[model samples]
Target: MGCCVSTSSRSTCSTRSHGGAVSPSCFEVGFCGQKRTKRTFSDHVIALQHLPSVPNRIFTNGKSRTSCIFTQQGRKGINQDAMIVWEDFMSEDVTFCGVFDGHGPHGHLVARKVRDALPLKLLSSMHSYQSRQNGSGRTCFRGNSKKSDGGDSEKDGSAEDRLNSIWKEAFMKSYKAMDKELRSHPNLDCFCSGSTAVTIVKQGSNLFMGYIGDSRAIMGSKDSNDSMVAIQLTVDLKPDLPREAERIKRCKGRVFALQDEPEVPRVWLPFDDAPGLAMARAFGDFCLKEYGVISIPEFSHRILTERDQFIVLASDGVWDVLSNEEVVEIVSSAPTRSSAAGILVDSAAREWKLKYPTSKMDDCAVVCLFLDGKMDSESDYEEQGFSSATLQSNHSGNAVESDDGQKSEPSLQRNFTVRSSEESDSYGRLPPEFEGNADTVAAEDQNWLGLEGVTRVNSLVQLPRFSEERPNP
Candidate 1:
């Protein structure tokens, strides 16, 4: 009465041993010793005699498969990061999710780099410098705890200072590595490649966040009706600010380098005036390395007590389509992280569908991390399929009233979950030495930013004429 689901013990692997376990498909297998039956779900299940302990493809719902490739070779003609990984053993608390939407060809590489290294960088930097005795040549965080005026030091420290120590070191190291990789192996797809980083670190009940570039981190929960508290952390590192514009005029607007284009994301006029950023600030664009691409990340701490709502981390794609508060309401209403991720991606895609109308599809990737929740049953993913994305014509998106005639807009439409795709198990297609490392890792020599940064594809995408070929904002 059980199908033997082979377990490779890898996060992406989904084998089936029918001991009250379920696969999306069903198949029958027969053996020589005794008549045996194995139920397969989707295309993942197969029946044969003397089968090896491992199967190339594991059981998957078949809605979608994890390509893990950021190159055009892996792009599935749509912009969606809809992954249903770790079918059963996903961690209930402290879920880490991120979205890397690249403005140019290098987007894919940027996305993969952050997913693999960003967290490790943050935690590692925090502990490394804080350690009193470390042989690594990095600076020890020994700032004066003295008071400004000869008075007794009342302020031992602010949370920002402690957090900034880590933020500064981690960002410095990560950006330097990212920039080095980008410069060495330039992705022709985008002459200027940069991405927004939004990280959600929920340690215990304490919620901490840090971001660079315009990728936003918005908060959502039911404390204040359907509205979400959009506390923006990172500022656009663009040189086009009014103050920057004025500074440029004063300096007679000195000659700009290939990287000094103020039109870049975080690049300000008069070059060294403000935090030097071409596309403002980012994790991996090495072109702006000379300008100290190291971005001072906005840091904050919030105890995720009863009043907090679901958290969202998305690329500029979602933000470009929806407002910050609008996103909060949408995800807050979402029952699960998977659905929330799906809804964000799909909704963004729909918006592109309307704007481009006649053009081909655009890429959109979204990931929503539901804070501290439990998924005890399958219905958690909705009964039939899942939540979906649709065209929203009438969006008075600017902070409206709720149906009780209350002024808050309910972010999610009730009873909405569109079932899209599921990951396909690798039972046969994998090489003998096949490990799931490549999906989440790059080759040792490929570490463009200390992790084998891959400048795989560099196709010049089409855009409106007279506009910047590579879109950074």
Candidate 2:
């Protein structure tokens, strides 16, 4: 059974009917029955009771076996987390889900803009690539299956190559476009503001993930022993990565950890010590663009089997306090599909308070997509040691270490607005003067500082093209 939840008791004035089932639009329903369009935390839950008509010109594409839930908690000021789930994102075979975590002064706006625009832009890029292929007298198939005139092995390799190339180009261009928009936006200043993006596009059993910055994507699958395991699908592109640090140094940028937090390495300008960005890749933060920071995303793809259960994408706030194993366990063991994201974020928020009492809790956002509605099978879940009672009993979960080195496990009380103005360090901002100096230095060394080398290296290595020849005009 597919289920969707509405967290608020209020009903909506306008409801949409899909496949004989009436679905409520949270936007039309105001909190407590009033009329408003602004989405508050109450309207956050969206559950499709039944899978809509599949392979049709309707929303949710052909993803009849998919269900998703998201939850967010604000900190430091405004909620810096923004996300979207587009059921019929592009075609009848695609579903797009993304989560963005904003940092710096204008991060909230940047995150929101990216959340609203990135998917459409990405879809457009993919469509353009396909159109170009069509013009070249080549056909491209959607999802995992493809039509080819080659042998089985050749077909498999060719299909993978085509899909990878399309996605790589799409991701690279979409990020560059998004960054360009951010820079040109009249109301927003992105010099020191930026957001991390972790996105997934599901077409049938095939999954394509594009990620930048520290946010991550994790897959929960059953092991041979029938135990749940978490598989990290995307790398955390932070300054600590050897290649990332090397690239920064090669581009004349500095990479080092703060005196207080020696374990967390950050990217800095060659001329100044301000705006210590933690992630080597991100959207906006133009202040560090010339200093080796980039918006290029890392892309990966996976074909799901029966063993795959679900995928979780979240910002660093969740990953900082929770391990991959713990996150998967909590998500797989959630009592309800809609509550999965909430429960995880709730647990993270509680951990943040207990772990870093003096520090302001970082904003937390999460997207959980259960595959094949498999979580609905109670007997199989129970046999796998994922009983509801076990989940409730182990509510305490695991103990986590705080930033200040304290360790604790607290009750999973949900708090969506856990902000404090007194928090000492809030994504330490770089003075305008520092940004000015960095820009000047980067401009002077643009030719010899290896910026072109870093850019070329950051680009994904191209895969063999399926259509090698273009039709003569």
Judging by TM-score against the true structure, name the best candidate: 2
Please provide, for model 1 over 1-473, each residue's C-alpha lDDT reduced to its tens digit, 9 standing for 90 to 100. Answer: 11222222222212322122222210111111223344212223212221211222111111111101111111223222211121111111222334444443345445544443443344344334434333443332212222234433334345325543554455466544444544454332223445556655443343545555555555555435744454333333333434333344454432232342211323322323322233344555433433444444545445454555455555544554465566666666655443565566666667545643443333444545444353313344444253221111111111111123323221100000011112112101111121343431122211011001211111112221333343342
Taking the tens digit of each residue's C-alpha lDDT, what string does model 2 give over 369-441?
A: 7766433444533543455653322222111211233221211111111112232122122222224444222
Per model, how many backbone clashes are there?
A: 57, 3
Stretches of candidate 2 off by over 4 Å are 1-65, 145-150, 373-473
Task: Name the weakest run of 10 consecutive residues (lDDT summed) in model 2.
Answer: 446-455
lDDT of 2: 0.58
lDDT minimum window of 10 residues, candidate 1: 411-420
| Full-model lDDT for every candidate | 0.36, 0.58
Against the true structure, what is each candidate's TM-score?
0.49, 0.65
| Cand. 2 TM to true fold | 0.65
Write down the lDDT that model 1 would get: 0.36
Error of 1 at 63 (Å): 14
Q: After superposition, how far is residue 380 of candidate 1 from its true place, in Å?
A: 2.7
